[model samples]
Target: MAMRVVDAAAAAIAALLGFVLALPFCLAAPSITTHGSDGGGGSYVSAVGDPGMRRDGLHVAWEAWNFCNEVGREAPGMGSPRGADCFDLENGVDENGQPTYKVVHRVTDADNNLRAGDPLPGSPANITDVDLYAAAKELYLGDRCQVPDSPSPWQFWMVMLKNGNLDTTAAICPENGRPARPFSQTSRFPCPGGAGCMNQPLVFHNRTALDATGRRLRGGLFGTYDLDAADLGSKEVSYYSVTWEKDLGSGGWVFHHKLRTAPKYPWLMLYLRSDATKGFSGGYHYDTRGMTKMVPESPNFKVRVTLEVKQGGGPNSQFYLMDMGSCWKNDGRPCDGDTATDVTRYSEMIINPETPSWCTRRRIEECPPWHTFRNGTRVHRTDAARFPYAAYHVYCSPGNARAAEQPTTYCDAYSNPQPQEILQLVPHPVWGEFGYPTAKGQGWIGDPRTWELDVGALSQALYFYQDPGTPPAKRKWSSLDVGTEIYVSKYAEAEWTLSGFDIVVPEDCVGSSQGGPLVPEFLILCDETLILEIPNQRVPISRGEEEQGKVTHTHEGCLEEVAAGEHLVGGRELAEIPDPAPDLGDAVAAGAQHDEHGGGDRLDHDGAAPALGAVDGEQREASERRAEEQHEHQRRLRGQQREEQLDHGCGGESVDPSNRWWARRRRRKWGRRDVGSGGISRRAIWGDGIRSSRSESSRRIHNGRLLEAVLGASSF
Candidate 1:
C-alpha cells in the first residue's frame, strides 16, 4: 500500500509537469538560433568570437608525454616533445613598390633545441632539475606567444602529444609520486618492446613567414617517434604535422593537423587545447599557463567554435567536438593543490559517427545510473528502452567514486594526472537541444559550421555522481578544447582543421552568479553588473484546454499518443519549488509517512507508475489542480513582497510590474529558462518537444521522460 501511494504521488507530480509542457510541443521545439547577449559575466574565455574566421596572434605551444602524461625520454636529439612557433605579422608596404611587412618569430632555434641537462638562459632559482627544463621550455614558448598591452599578460594555445606506451620492465614511472616496483607484462598495458618503446618524438619546426601569395602566410611543426628511422623527407614511418596558415588581408588563421601511426609507435594522441593563463590545467599537476584567463563555472557559459574533420582516424580515434576540463576536491571544496584529493572531471562530445557506444546493458559500469533530460527529470539506466544508448560513447567513473553504483567501470588511470571521470556524449538527438549536431557527420569534413552551444545549460543536465551525503561540487571547468586523441593503431592517419574558438557567458549571470574557488589572478574588474538575483515567480496563463484550466493545440494526421488531461503536482513535490540547496540527494525517499500522502492510496496503474504517466486525459485533471496551485504560489509570493515593502515603506519605494518584467526579460536574455515541474516553465523543459514524433523518436534526447511521451517520442 505504501509503495502504491509513493507511485501515485509521483504520477500526480508528473501529470502536472505534463500540462505545463503541452504548449511547447504544439509550438514546435525551440530552434538553435542566436540570442543577443551583453558581455557581463565572470569568464576568461577565448579571444575570438567569430565562428567563420580563424583568428591569429594566437599563442599555441606543444608538449609530448609518455603513457603516464610524462616525458619518458627525449627522442634522440629532441630535447622534449614540447615546443612552439608563435609570431606576429605586421602589414605594410615596402619602400619601393610591393606590399611587405616584417612578420617576426619570437622563439629561437636554440630555445627549441635545448636538451634535458642544458641550463636555460635565465633559469629561475626555484627550478632545479627536470622542473627547470620544463619551465624554461614553457617560458621560451611564452616569450613567443606573449600578447602585450593588457594588464594581465597571456600565452599561446597548447598542442599536446602523448605516446601510450609504458615501459613496465623498466618501471620508470613512479606509483602515485613514489617509486614503482618492477613488474612483468600481463597482456594489459601496451609496452611492446623493451627500453626504446617509450621514447619521445624527434621534433622539427618551420617558422612562419609571408608566402609568395604575398597575401598568405604559413608555418608548421612536425615530428616522428621512430628515432633511428630516416623518414623526415617523407611520412612513410610514424609522423605528425600541424601547419597553420592564414591570408594576411583576410580571415582568422587556420590550423591544419595531420597524424599518422607507425608500427613502433602504434598508439598516439594529439590535441589542441585552450589551457589556463596561469594555473594548473585539467591534467597538469603544475602551475600552468593557458587561454582561459578566467575559468567559467557550471550552468553559466557556452562555447562557440567551428570544426571540420576530414578523416576519422580508424576505430580507436576519440575525436572530441568539444571537451570540457575541470578540477575539484571530492569533498566539494575547491582544489587547493592537493594531488591525492583533487580530481579531474571531463565531459566530451565524441563526434566519430562510426564510434560504437560501449555503454550497453551488459556494460552498466560504463553508464551512469541515470541520464538527465534537458528538463530536470531523470531516467534510470535500467529503463533500457528510455536511456539514450547510441547517444553516448561511454561514461567512466572518477577513480575515486567510493560508493559508485554497483558494477561500475572506472576511467583509464594511466592517462590523467590524478583519478579522472569521463562523460563521453555522442552525436545523437539527445544533444540537439543544446544546438549540437543532431546527426552523424553534421559538422565533419564536407560540412563546416558556426555552433552556438548552451554548454552551461546542457552541462547542468548531465550526470556527475557523488556520495549521497556529500555537497554538490561546483562544476568549475579549468580547460575547454577541441581535438582528437588517435589511439595506437598502425598504418593509419587522421586530419582536420579548427578555427574561431570562443567561450561565452550570459551577460546577466556573471560575477557572483557562477560560483567557484576564488583565484585572485582571474578576476580583475570584478564587475557587479553581471550579478543576477533570480526571484522565483510563476507566471499563470491559461495554455492547454480552458474549462480544464489548460491550453494547447494539435497537429493534423499525427501518430496517436496518450490523451492530455488534468492532474497536477501535489505532496512533497511542491516543497521548495525553486533552487533548493545543492546538497539535496537525488535518491528517492523510500516511503511516505501518515499525513504525507496526497489524499488516498494510489496505483502503479500500468508497467510504469501512473503519476509519472504525465500524458492522457489525466493531464486534464492535473490542469485543474495546477491552476489552483499557481494562484496560491503567486499569492504567497506577492504577500511576502508586500510585507518586505511595508518594512521599508519609510523609503517611499515600491516593486513595480515593469521592474519584474525587466528582470524576467534579462533571465530570458541569458538563456536561463528554469525548467522544472515545481517552478520553471513547461516551454523550458520541452525544448525538443516540437519535433514530430517520428523525428524525435529517431534521435535520443535528455528532456525528461514526460517530454518524450508528450512529444510522442521514444528513447534508447
Candidate 2:
C-alpha cells in the first residue's frame, strides 16, 4: 500500500512538471489571424511605438527641405529647421483625492533653436555645413524624444516642409545625384526669384501647453517659405502650420495642417511622415530617425488613418492619400547611400478628383511597362483594352536605369538627392480590393472617413523597375506620409486634419528573425486555463469551446481574440487534437505547422530551438504517454470533487486536487497564500526546460533530463 501511494505521488509530480514545461513553448508559438481591414492570416503587431496616435504624451518633430530634399541654408534666426515637441504626462492625486496631471517637456526651446556653427550634443565637432548641421540636429532631437521598445527604440513623427523652387541658373540642386553646372532657367524649373530660390522657411514654435481645464494639450509649428513676408496672414505670402491637440486619456491626437503657396515659393510641399527610426529614409542619404520602429515590408503591412480635407490646395495640388518610399539599386540590391548609384522609389495614390491620368493610349511613356492584377495576371501597357490606364496617373523610370524598357518617361533628375522612379496612381476600381478610393470623389473635400488601407497588398502589385535578370529587391518601405504638394501654384491653400494614424505589420515580421522575444513570457497551466504574465500585469485568458471544431481564447484587455477555428495557445496556433486524450506530440507537430503557416519555428539567438527538439524520439513518446495519463487523472479528480460537492453541499472551500496541491506548495515555499511577486520565479518550471537559480552552476536542465527523471521515479 505504501509503495502504491508513493508511485501515485510520483506520477502526479511528473504530470504537473510536464504541463508546466510545455506551457511556455505553446504560448510562444506564432499564430495566424487576419488583422485590420486586410483579410489575411498572420500574427500582427504595431510597427510604431505609439500605435494609432493614442498616447496622451506626444512626440513630434519638424524639418524643412530645399528643392533637392536638402537644406541649402537656414532661414535667418530660425536655427537648423529641425525642431521637436515631446512631453510626458504625470498623473497624481491631489489632497482631495482628485486626479491631477502635469505636462513634462523633453525637448526645450533651446534645443530646437540650435543652428549651424553651434556645437550640438552627439554630433561631430566643427561641422558647419548648413545641410549637415540640419541632419545632425534631427538626430540630436530624435535622441531627446526617443521611446524605448522591444526590437528597437523609436522617435517622433515628422512634419516635413519643402520649398520646391529650384534655381537652375544657380546650379543649387544636383542632376540625378551628380554635380550640376549653371544653366538658363525655364518654365520647366519653377524659380520665380533667381538666386537663393531654394531657401529654408522661417519656423515659429507654439510650445505645447495645457489649457485652463488641464484636460487638453495643444501645440504647433507654423512658418512661411517667403522669408521676407511681414505678415503670415497676408494672402501674397506662403504659409504652413502643423498643430497637434489631444484630450487627456481619450482618443487620438488630431494633427491639423495648413499650407499656402506664394509667387516666390510657388511650388511647396508639406507632409506628415512616419520615417524609419534608423538608417536612411526615402529621399535622404544621411541616417535619419522617426516613428517607425519596425520598418514594414511589402505584402505584410497595413496603414490606418482618419483624414478630413477641409480644402484642396488647387487643381495643381498633388494630394497624396498615401505615399510610400524606399531605396534600392537598379541591380535589386539595398541602397548604400551612394547617391550616384542608389535610386529612390516612390509610389503614391493621388486622391484629387480633378487630377487627370496622364497614362493615355497615346502617352505610353507615362504608363508602366506592365501592370499586375491582384490575381497575379499581367497586362502590358500596349494592351490598351485590358490595361487599366485610369488607375494610373503616371509612371516615371529612374534616370540612371541602364535597362529601362522603351517608351519610359524618366523622372525629373533634380527632384531628389538620387535618381528616382515614381509611380502615381488615381482612384479606380482595380484598387478597390485594397480598400482605396474606387471613385473620383470618394474621400475628397466633403467626404471625411477613417481609412484602413491595404497598403501592403497594393504595393506588392504595383510596378517598380529593376534591371533585367537581377534578383528582386526586398521592398521594405522606410518612409510613409500623407499630405499635398502644391505644384508651381500661387496663392493656393490646403487644409486637412489627420488622426488615428498607424502602421501594423505581422508580429513575426518584427523580432523573430532578430532573435528577440516575440512577446512577454506566458504560461498556460492546464488545457482549460491560461495565465499570461507580462511585465507588472497578469491577464487571464479564458478558453471558449462553445463552437464545434473551433477553440478560441479571449484575452481580456490584452490582445484581440483568436479567430474562429484557430487553436491559438500562447500567441501560437496548435493543430487540432483528439477530444478524449490530446497527446503532447500534437504540440510538437503544431510547431512544424507554425513554420508552414507563415513565420518559421521560433529560434534562439544562435538559430536553434531552445528546448522543443531537446527530447529524443523515444523520450518524446514516453512523455506523450505520461501526458495522456495526467489528463485522465485530472478528469477523475474533477469528477470525484464534484461528487463530494453534491453529496455534502460544500460551498466555500474548494476540493480540486490541483488547487490543494498548489495551495500546500505555496505555503511551504513562501509561507504565503499567493505566488511570488505575481510573476514566474527563476526556480519555477518554465520554457527552455527548468531554469536553475542564479547561484546554480548549470543555468538550464533540458526537458529530456526532466522527462527521464519523471519516468525513473514513476517506475518505482
Candidate 3:
C-alpha cells in the first residue's frame, strides 16, 4: 500500500519557512482552492502582490547602465534612464452582464522624461549628481507602485539593461571600489574609439493600454545604444525591446524580450530580477524595491520558473537559466554595503551547450576546493574520479581576500561597486539530482518545459568560500534573476520569452527539530494545469478492501495522515524554477546631451528662468490648452475605483502533498480573488518554493552579532 504523505520532512521545513504544503481535496466540488500556511483552517493568501502574475493590474520598471553600472552621462532629452509602467485594472459588468475592464496608468510620460539636473515637478529638491538622481528616480517610481503587505510593501519586477564597454583611459570605474589609476587599452575589454563610448541609451516606453476589444493589456519599452540612429528601425545600431501582454482572464502575463548586438557595442546584459522590496540587492549599493518582500535563505527556499530561449548570442553568450546573488563580508557576516569590506556573491547555471567547463584536471585553481553530493559527502578537487569537474564552468574568488588560495582566478575588480565572487555552472548529469538540466539542450529553443528546481537543496550543497574556522554564514539570498550576458558578441541577437516565474519560502521560522530554521512542506506542482493527481497504487488500502478486490473508496487514492516532520520515503520528484532574457552590447558611441567641455553650448540649462509674465501670451495660451487636454485624458484613465477582481496570470502553481491530503477530507472551494496588500500570517509561504517568514525581519541575529547593526552603519 502506498503511504499518502500529509507530513514530510521537507514539508515541515518548508512550513516553518513559509512554503505552501498542499492538503488533499476535502470536498466533492469542481473548484480550485488556495490555502494559507499559518495552520489555521486553510485559506489562500498570496505572498506577493501579484500572485502567479495573474493580475490585470501590472507593476514593472526598467533601468539602463554603462560599463560600471553607473550613469556616467545621460542620453539627450531622456531623463536618468529609469522608467516604470504601473497601473490598476478596473472591472465592471456591462449592460449585457459581461465583464468590461480598463487600464489605469499611474506614471506619466512627463515624469519619466525628466533628465538629470532637471528639477522634479511639484516635488522637493534632491541630489543633482547623475548617479544619485537615477537612484532617487527609482525610489520615486517605487512610491507610485508600492503595494502594502505584511512584511513590507513591494514595487515591481526590475528589467535591467547594461552596456559592458569600459573606456580604460577614462578611469570612471574604481578598482574594488577604491579609486584606480588610468590604464591603457587591453584586449580583455573593448572600447569604440574612447570618447562618448560610455554614454547611456535612448529609451522609449509604450504605456500599458487595452486592445480594441479591451480583452488584452499590452505595453513595451524599446531603444538602442546608438543615440544618433533615427530609431530601432535604423541599421548598424544595437537594440533592445521587452514587450509584456496578457489575455483577459486567460492566465499570467507573458514577457517577450529581444536583444541585438552591434560591432561597436559587442557586450551587453539584460535580466528580469525579483529583488528584495526594500534593501540592498546583490551588486547594488543603494536600497532597492522589488517583488520579494521576504528574502529567502539557502536550504529553505526553492524557485519555480518557465523559460524559452529563442536565439543564443553565438558561442560567447553565457545564458543563465537560473542566476542567484547575495552579499556578505569575509567574516561570514551579511554585507552592509561597505564597498571595501563587502563582497557580492553570485551563482549562475549557464545552459548553453557551447559553453565549456574551465575547471579541468590540470586547472585545480579554477575549481572549488570541494564538491558536495546530495547525500552530504564531500570530495576534494584532487579526487577527480569522485569530483564532478564538468559540473562547474568556473569559480572565481573575491579580489579582497588576504590569504588567498594559490592559482585562483579573482573576479573582475571593476564590474561592481565592491569586490565580488562568482560561480558559473554548465549543464551536466551531476545537477540532475537537484532537478536542474541533466544534459545539454533540455530547455533550449524548441524544447520548453516548466521547471520546479530544488534550488534550496542544490544551493546548500554548492561550495562557497569562507574564512578559516569562522562559523558558516547564513545563506540569505537578496536577489534572484535569469537572462543572458553576451560577452563581446559582435553583431549577434538573442531573444526569448519568460513566464510563470516565482520563488517559494517557508511560512515561519520558529525553532525546528533539527536545531536549524529549515523545515520542509511538501509542494507538488503539476505543469500547465493546477490539478494534482496521485495514483491509487501510491496510496495504502485497508485490509478488508483486498478481500473485496477494491480499497475503501476515498476517491481514487488512499489517504494517510502521518506525523509532521517525517521523511517522505517514497514519492515522485518535484520540479524546479526558471529565469529570463539576454545580453546588452559593447559600449558603442552614444550621445550625451551636455557638452564634454565647459565652454560649449549647454543643451538644457539657460542663463535665466522663463518668466510667468505677459510676454508671448498666445504661445502660453496654446501650451496651457495642451496641458489641460493631457490632464483630462489622464483623469479619465484613473477616475475609476481602485479595487476589483484580480485577473491572474497562469504560473506559480504549487501543491503541498500532506496539506492537499487534508483538504480532501471535506468540501472546500476557492474562487478568484484580488491579490491584495496586507500583513501576512507568520506562517505565509511564498509560491516559488523559497522559504520566508512574514514575522521575521531582515535584521537577523547570528552568533551574538546583529545584522541590523551592520546595516545601520552602511550607506543604505
lDDT of 3 at 382: 82
By lDDT, the better pick of 2 and 3 is 2
lDDT of 1: 0.53
Question: Order of candidates by lDDT, top first?
Answer: 2, 3, 1
**Candidate 2: regions farther than 4 A off:** 1-43, 512-716
lDDT of 3 by residue, 1-716 (tens): 11112122123223322322333221111111212212464332333556667777889999888877789899987889889999988888999998888787888887788777777654588567998888888888888888876445789988999988888888998888788788998867788746777788888899999999888889999988887776565436899999999987788998898888787788888888888776678788877878876666555456778899999877888888899988887666667868898888899999888889999989989987667665545577788788899989999888897644566888899888898889898888988877899888888888877887756556656766655423235566778888889998777788989888787653432112223333222222111101112211111111110111111111111121111111111122222100000011111112212211101122332222111111135754664554455554433322311210011111111211111121221111111121110111112223321123333422221211111111111111
Index of the highest-TM-score prediction: 2
Candidate scoring better on lDDT of 1 and 3? 3
Using TM-score as the measure, name the better of candidate 1 and candidate 3: 3
lDDT of 2 at 339: 93
How many clashes does each candidate structure show, in the order listed?
A: 41, 3, 84
Per-candidate TM-scores read 0.65, 0.68, 0.66
TM-score of 3: 0.66
Worst 10 residues of 3 by lDDT: 576-585
Task: Give the lDDT of residue 244 in candidate 1.
Answer: 83
Note the Cα lDDT for every prediction shown. Answer: 0.53, 0.67, 0.60
* Strongest candidate by lDDT: 2
